[model samples]
Target: MDVALQALTVLAAIALGVRTKGLTVGLWGAAGVLVLVWVFGLPPGSVPTSAIFVIFAVVTAAGAMQAAGGIDYLVGIAQRVIRAHPNQVTFIAPYVAWLFATGAGTGFVYYSILPVIYEVAYGNKVRPERPMAIAPTASQMGITSSPVSSAMAIMVGLMAPLGFEITNILSIVLPSTAIAIGAAAFVQNKIGKPLDRDPVYQARLAAGEVTAPEPVDIGVASASAKRSTWIFGTGILLILAFGIFEGLRPVIPGADGPEPLAMTTMIQIIMLIVALVILLWCRTRSADVPRAQVFRSGMSAIIALWGVSWLANTFIAANEDSIVEGLGGIADNAPIFIAVALFIVAALTTSQSSATIAIIPIGITLGLEPWQLTAMWMAVIGLYTFPINGSQLATIELDATGSTRISRFVIYHSFTIGMLVMAVVSVLVGLGIGGIFYG
Candidate 1:
């Protein structure tokens, strides 16, 4: 089969899957793999077993926490902070969103708090779009810094052969991305007219189309909710601490004397243990676990990654020589092009883990350094460039003031500036950090 035709098949599968929505995309991806195997005579690619399991276990724990009211408890704290610093909401709100994503290790947790950001900013006469637009993007950016994020898991595994570990990735990404998100918040604060001075908002108000978003009345916080919140947070801290201090994980006797637990297995065990604790002590209904938002989103990601990554990898493996011959000269001369390629792939696939699995091997094959690849990891957050996903749609919906919107050109959506700022700044910062420490 012609490599161009093979590539087109992969693209067609992605387009069809995205168009159909839901689980169908994954099915399409699987179908692509079958077509390549049966029609093109390509070898079967390995499933992303480690990435899938890590996502499942971590999301199961997060979902358990959500079902037990732990999510509400965390959001309650964020609400109080926003209420207390109404004048500083433009600055405070994005960090609150960042904390939620960083702690939960998935951007889905931001949905529970998006309404709060809108309400607080609106009540204070702030341009709701300023914070509303950037908060969710900031949360997704937080994934790279999240110690247990599935994307980070894939990144860590990919960089391992280059002598980079989870700790090294964290040291570079955490501070770099954190500061980049803060920079985005600062820039967003000045993005549009203040709510009272805004023309669109005033027109809506004059036409009786806009009103204050109804205040959310979260009932009293329960003891179980508080217990679950702390327990879940503690679990996140443990993951961070162990990730930073490699010796903390228990070493099992091995032929090599002793071997520390693999990070993948460690994450699976820790998250499942947290879920068990939440159920046993927090009194969470076991039946509700799979129904939680985190679980549903995680499962969708797993399916998307399973099919998409497999199809992509199969295509790439089949066309390795052709790809190398065509792009090798440019890659050798300007390796930073690798990051640009990743950003483009992420925008198209709309899945960070999928993009990472698809392209990082090519970087290695082209002799890009570990630090270079680590910095390029920041480029995967480009999934927000198109703004068609659930989180972006939720932001557009939650803002009653109509200040948050998608422009006629889809690329000009509310999140474009912040996402671009974050992606650029984090990649540059990661590059600098990786060079200094890993050099």
Candidate 2:
């Protein structure tokens, strides 16, 4: 009875957070933690200080890059790429979205390119929904694969202690997610009616509600923009190099032996330097960094991760013995249940970092191998199960042609098929890659 009540408290907090959206999720999670500690008498768990600081550093650099026009420069390049392949916008657009998210280390960068995607598709008389719906899903999937993203930061922090390096995680995820995006795009191309045959779009066209897409004017990249983007790209490359070749890292004498600097600490140091370099060399004002969209979104993720992860960790710590006893046998026999749990939690939270911080630890405790858990990491894209995600809503609003839409049945929205396909394919591919690498 006590355990059941504690579980109910955690669920109720997550439900309220999802209902309210935005920063309130953190507030509600903190409230749940208070109740658990004061009312239920459970001890508080350790705060996720390492993950929080890594997110802060990475977001700082990304925000600095955005303030210095790096994101605009990248978006201009994406615009040209999509426009060049008008007929294949469905195939090209999602990959562009994924690339932007992976490079910028945040999916919010997908917003600037959304209108461009709509223009390219609509101008070609293709269904805007075909590309727009799946683009956001692809962007979200990119987060799991991004080295500097909050989800990846938390994942690295968790798995590094178990002998899994950043390279191993990325090796499994990057190829799997990239392949999954392609599979989803292929599936999405076959969905929906042709734009000319679509009644809603035709009706909108006849009524003059839909206008011809205006030419996208992604302004030329100024010197400042080009410099900042190159600097940021250099930073990402350096991080990847250090991760792939641990010998490149500085070694310090320790109590036992010389220890190479930890990747978590290295990431923080490098990103902080990157932010400072962009600010000084690119002539960007420090005041504008905090105001950047990526910074705002990243801060919200930190808050949500802090409260929710603390609550979850505390609850799990308090009931570790019981939880392991109850779920261990099932997990050992049917490991897919662990993936399903990750998917459901991700869908409920709608924040990849929060979902990761909250659930991955549980999987670890259930005696699952790090490779097994890593293989299932892409399952977090289930956040798209509902159409309430910001990117999904933005895509719907951006399509003036009325081709993209949510069905009366909420679950049957435009993004559903692509999201489902991506989830299934990525996990299967990840399992195969993980087996080769770690089996």
Number of the top-ranking candidate, with TM-score as the measure? 2
The digit string of per-residue lDDT tens for model 1 on 69-152 reads 888888788777777888788788778888777887888767877887888888888889998888888888778778767788
Runs in model 2 lying further than 4 Å from the true structure:
253-255
- Top lDDT hit: 2
Worst 10 residues of 2 by lDDT: 335-344
For model 2, the local distance difference test gives: 0.90
Task: Compose the digit string of candidate 2's lDDT tens values, residues 148-168.
Answer: 999999999899888887888
Give the Cα-based TM-score of candidate 2 against the true structure.
0.98
- Alpha-carbon lDDT, every model: 0.82, 0.90
Q: State how far residue 236 of model 1 sits from its true place (Å).
A: 2.2
